[model samples]
Target: MPVHRPGTARREHHAAGVLLAVLSALALLLTLPGAAQSADGENVPPRGSARMGQGVLEHDGQGGEPRGGDAVQTEGVDVSSHQGNVNWSALWSSGVRWAYVKATEATSYRNPYFAQQYNGSYNIGMIRGTYHFATPDTSSGAAQANYFVDNGGAWSRDGKTLPGALDIEWNPYGAACFGKSPSAMVSWIRDFLTTYKARTGRDAVIYTATSWWKQCTGNYSGFGSTNPLWIARYDVSPGELPAGWGFHTMWQYTSSGPIVGDHNKFNGAYDRIQALANG
Candidate 1:
């Protein structure tokens, strides 16, 4: 017969209670907002230097030919503070025509190299525009839009200044969809678009990946008629677009182009790019 000691039982119960308490605390921590766990189960904070296409490059692999099967397309590139002091002359010499510079993010971050990248592209005769990295989890879309406009996302009829683009993709910091449900995400986007148009009188361009769009926004299509879509897909072709968009206005074909930043394609010829800027 096995003899059960009273003290042993009491000690075992106390140890089990401690273990359970620890586990419960861990579970609660994981449920907290901005709590992110890596694949190896390590907690990781959000990256502060999130740039244009950072999520796309992280989720989607690089390398691909431009889609549209040999159709006429104007080349472009998108840059952030990562590509400090871009060599605009070299990109211009490489047949690049249009550029998008990272402007503001979540109303908190403004690209330090915005002036150089934005003006250098324009000075090099490239139709250049700005983009705002959306962080719907941090602030209201309208507030972020106002912040973007005040910083560098304003539009002009200079015939070389393209309307700003809203770069909404996977959250590099925490939850992929910023912890919002599909409908809530859609509403946030609508608010941003509405406010952007009100501030600039131009429908802002939307830069997104189809997979992220479908997963986050439930494949919302309401913006297709107004916002120009800048689709990011690094493959032999732009696989499939999100709902409502009949065609992509811009396609980011490759992240590892022979240039400084991610290379993209304006869906039409150089004249179309100029037309978009002129608008």
Candidate 2:
């Protein structure tokens, strides 16, 4: 065997050590879950930053104030069984003009309070709509969308009924992206929107955080101008929207508001909002 110099062996060993370190770091980054990697790797701000009982603010960069500067906007609330026995009349009297009720979740779970919240808000002279909480891991989007419409997503020519909304946010059960690839999530959303529109004759609104949308759906913007965007961010200006949307349709600014659940701001005036409800 050829004899090697001691200094050369030391240099080689050092190089190998550096290489192993680099590989380990790369592996760790690859294994880390795709969280909010928006601009500054900070989007999807914390929930209920400006609330009474909500916890410490997350301060993610994804959320912000409503758009449409100088234009008068409408305030609304979104609720489900989480907020038990809502007082819709009091909310209306408090200047809340609209509501989005959680109607269904995944494929099997339906909100028991959907009828009461939906009809209650409408009866109190508030524009009301139903939203489906997407559980992509549990079932296909089309199936979930059908279940939503069958339960409470169907809208009528009644001027106060807004189109159904697709609530695609964090994965409550499993992986953050529901263990699906970005392309898979985009496909699921398309399936849900396609089926929803076909059944209801109206486009479904999409509610998501900026970073969550980017991470989960690869920032999919295929819905174009049809599906309205409802961006969820607490205590910050929605710095950037997802692809294909310059402004948001509604902004869910907080979770614990005057009436509980989520507090929302429609981007346009009451007339424009009425126009949206009509469709």
Candidate 3:
């Protein structure tokens, strides 16, 4: 879970084209909101994925344009999928105010570089920092929380990291890896969050993609209002935010960007995010 607060559905019909069109439109709107919105008030992107906003990342085919810190805003990215092979100094030089590093996955797997990279960055002073877990399909929210607490080296003397996150994305593990049900998932997540809160004495945050929420966990209603949300919607811009979430702290709007000294491309976001994070 993330500090920012971060939903949808379908009918019983054979509408593959319609579904693709809808998702495509949404992606376009999300990736290119400025281009799509016109004087006629008609968005060019498809349906379900529209609402792109500024700060959305872009790729230039061969490579991406490097974007770092400016007097204008904060910059950050998701390093969960990214192996610990990043150049921390490049990001620091690029004006990275925060970092959401992937620390653990469920109970068995851990980010090989979490311990080294997390502490490495913290020691060097990278503003605020946090960790997110790669949730597994099986129900083991407590174990996941424990993994983060135990291994996530970055934390305040009080216990929790400056912020903590739950990276709940679509189950890419196939059908068997499918969810246990929205309610069950919510229960599991709540359990993990509560466990973390008890240990750290801070509210846990949830990070998720927009489509996952819309189709799967949009209606989840058990958590308290204090929980924050961190959402990921890669569109043309960072437009149309989710409504169900009462609070949101961060928005991961881009997936590709130019950062200093990194072997591969990276992601970035707007500078005004500190306001959104309330930091």
Q: What TM-score against the true fold does each predicted structure earn?
A: 0.84, 0.76, 0.62
lDDT of 1 by residue, 1-279 (tens): 989987999999999999999999989988675576777676665444777778786787765565466688888999998899999999999999999999989977889898999989989899899999999999999999999999999999989989999999998777899999999999999999999999999999999999899999999989999999999998888879999999999999888779799989999999999899888
**For model 3, what is the error of residue 149's alpha carbon versus the real structure, in angstroms, after optimal superposition?**
1.0
Q: After superposition, how far is residue 167 of candidate 2 from its true place, in Å?
A: 0.3
- Which prediction has more favorable lDDT, 2 or 3? 2
- RMSD in angstroms, candidate 2? 11.0
- Residue lDDT tens for model 2, 37-117: 333344332211112112213324334444556757789999877787889888988889999988877777677776788
TM-score order, best first, reads 1, 2, 3
Worst 10 residues of 2 by lDDT: 47-56
Off by over 4 Å in 1: 1-47
TM-score of candidate 3 to 2 decimals: 0.62
| Stretches of model 3 off by over 4 angstroms after superposition | 1-73, 157-161, 221-224, 260-279
